[model samples]
Target chain A: DKKKQLQQLDNFIEGVLQEALEEFKQVE
Target chain B: MEERIFGTECEYALFHQLPPPSAQGSGKTAKWSGTSFSENLQEMSHLLVCALRGQNRPLAGEFLANGGRFYIDRGSHPEYATPECRSVADVIAHEKAGDRLVQKLVEEAGGLMAEKDIPGRLHAFKNNHDPRGNTYGSHENYLVSPRAMEKIQQIIPFLITRQIFAGAGKIPHLAPPAFSGEDWLPFAVSQRADFVEHVLSDRASDARGIINTRKREITRSGDNVRLHVILGDSNMSEYALKLKIGTTALVLRMIEDGLGDIPAFLQPVQALKVISRRPAGVHAVEGAGSGHTALEVQSIYLEKALGYFSSHAATGEEKAVLCLWETTLSGLKNLRISPSGVIEDDPGELSRKLDWVIKAWLLNRAREKKNLDWSDPHIKHLDFRYHDLDPETGLFERCASLGLVDRVIEEEAILLAMEAPPHNTRARLRGGIIGEAWGKDVEVLVENWESIRIIAKSKVDGMHPFARQRRSVNGLKANLNDPFEGCNEALLKRVRRFLDKCDEV
Candidate 1:
């Protein structure tokens, strides 16, 4: 269960940066 | 005045599900390793058409015996458009018939794949958007008198708010964590709402609009313009489909009778998103006062419709719609959903009758049992399975088989709708010809909705002395331009003439 907690901490940062970068590129 | 013709087109997502490779624990995919599913989807669509056509050879455009069109749409979307219907019940029945027919074709495709030693199960989804940002359409076509366009603004608000009941409900497969928490809406009312980029646009692939301005088929005679609505979701709930079409038709009747003074949304796109994203929250409607709920806006249109029908000579269908509209409005007022992504109160059974509520109820229970998030894989799988066309496995079908959701039509009606066209419209004539000819070995080509081309299906060795006579009748095109044309004696005479010539040869 504590190992599950380790993965839970990463949900916010997961794929957000790549997704935002792709969206910004689309504006061009 | 003549009854208006109504039609519906549903673009389905065809895929074959394969278990993920044993080495990788990634989710299940509807693809082969070397080939993308999109490439296979095209072949799958052709296989479905061929199965229905039976050795008649695959033409990319083939009309079914039931007077409906089944063909590969813009992308890999296998589309089925219901025949023109004069009555609301006929539209619902025909649309349901389309689903049954599509499911049967999907089964046939699965069997064909199995025979060829393919590794997966083929499934078709009557849904709007995919895990990626791609969206297909579930479009509605209402034949309006030419002058009805001038008063179209009067109904935009009604169209925007109609999603409260009309929405097919979206729970994305790849929902990001941003929309996950209790404060943000985990579920959207309409899947197509956010994809509507314009108020009116001709482009359907991109710059999509609420009312697709592109004229799908050329309406030459009767001065009719088909009002093509692309915003609707492909409904699994029959009651939702009936209310959506029936209510919109009644309001169009009001507009045709020159009923004006209905308020236009100040920013329709903004209003559409707000109603879809926050169904229970206070809506910031532009001119008609802020803080009104989605139900209140629908009430405005419903009240006006009730008043108009009271004075006007409303049909039996119109009267039933008014009753349903009033009751549904009252029911919606009593229904409540909490911010924690759960249905708190649905006293009026709107959840059972509407798609969004039915889904929210199911999703809420699943979450409560396992304490799962909105983006959880289990919840997403349930959402996708709900719209699956398979009766044995689709969640909606299971709910329907269990008598959990409301059913508006009977099994017999849907079966009949599959084989026969609506008795009242030009489709009857078209369907009669298709069924009569296809029953024999005669090959017919449906060039478009309004035209049919027929040729004598024969063998080269079988060519006889009367080959010249067959040539006279071959490639004869019949144009049934009028949507109101009945299957009369004159049309039958011409069709019989062609069939007779082929027989003589």
Candidate 2:
């Protein structure tokens, strides 16, 4: 259960990073 | 500085132990070399930078989404610096945001290391001292007028004695060269007590001091001095962090107004060490015209602060701090005078809001259960784990989840702070410019606290640290300088115009 929580946080970070990268690509 | 701005720089280690290269599963009997250590640190730093850059975000400068930033420091430790904030609440929010940011980065790095089949796990702790006698720091910065230097002298005694409540309690360690024999403490109120060797010094690492005299100004103007404090422990309790900064700010305010006569400590550094070791107020110091215990010294300052609050109109936060300070002093006094040596009135109540109390409670419980001595390694491990930043495993987070500790900010507030800056300070503008240029083909250079350069097209100069207006090099101005003012239409329009022009050919 604790590992799952950590995975969720990691997933959240990955998602934010992906979104930011996508936005940068569009702007460029 | 009109309102005291606050910021913190937190340095944290990456790995608990650096395994030798030969110990790796590669089956090569290579001799241990410095390259292994360097390589490990470099890998860690690279992973951290990648995490900070996010998936697709352009690396503009040192700042992140919220008022947080991180970089690799001299010792290969990752250091996170929160953006300047106007209130203690905002500071706490941004500081917690720093913790989240660091945790996220560390987790990502560990995953990467595992993928590469690294030999050891990378564990991070938000604490000051390592077992090898080296010290990291959680330095607190406050923007004060240059004229407040004299007032700083009056506040040193209060700073020395504030450890009774402000300390992040530590398990006993071998005494430093300066302190031994009877002075060797079984427990210390502050983790940084043994390392502080001077009353005031400019050096941070070697020859550390209570009040740092570093004369570097981050602002554009020469009117304000940044009061950099390196004495405090890296606190895990939000309530303790709030009170630590809040009470200090209140005392500084009193000093600036020339409202109280703060007694001088005969030997300030020694007094700091003594009070830190024996925070229950029994240790006597020769100062304030007579020998006074830490409790008496604190009480004197508390009385003067109460007098100032009664006469002056204090803000809601100020009022809260006054009440907490009074209640804390009373609790300490009661604990000292009682023959039982136990807090009888409301057992474990203070533990909810104070780090030292909460830690003492946990340590005492463990000691009774396991029949362990104060210097046991398990006790030290428990102390270290309390300050770990892992959400699922950190002792402080576990206690907070069970409602054993009081929280100063809500979880949602901290989450929001991870992506946005506080509304009422120059950080808002800083965060605004960085957010605006997040994905655009523009260079956002934050040279210092007072100036931001936007791709040589628009250079905004915020000469006054508290002012909201950013004067463009091309004479186009955006006035959002009021620290309390929220986003206004006129300022937004002006900023948009400047940004639009930068976007143009």
On TM-score, the candidate that comes out on top is 1
Question: DockQ values for all predictions?
Answer: 0.03, 0.02
After best superposition, candidate 1 residue B27: deviation in angstroms?
20
Listed per candidate, the RMSD to the true structure in angstroms reads 7.5, 9.4
Interface RMSD of 1: 13.2
Every model's TM-score: 0.86, 0.81
Candidate 2 lDDT over residue span B1-505, tens digit each: 3377788888876653335555665542242222222346666777877767764543347766564677888878789888778788888888888888788888887777667655555567788876555678989988776567766887788888888888888864564455434424457778887789998999998898889998775753346667899999888889889888998888878877775566677778888887776554344344434477787888988899899888888888888888888887877665431221223354427777888777776666555556766666556666666777876556676667666688978888788888888886666776776777665545677655554555534443344321244333433333333433435555555556566654553
Q: List the residue pairs that clash in candidate 1.
A: none
What is the C-alpha lDDT profile of model 1 across B311-364, one tens digit per residue?
Answer: 878888888888988888888888777776688888889878999888888777
Winning candidate number (DockQ): 1
TM-score for candidate 1, please give it: 0.86
Per-prediction interface RMSD in Å: 13.2, 18.7
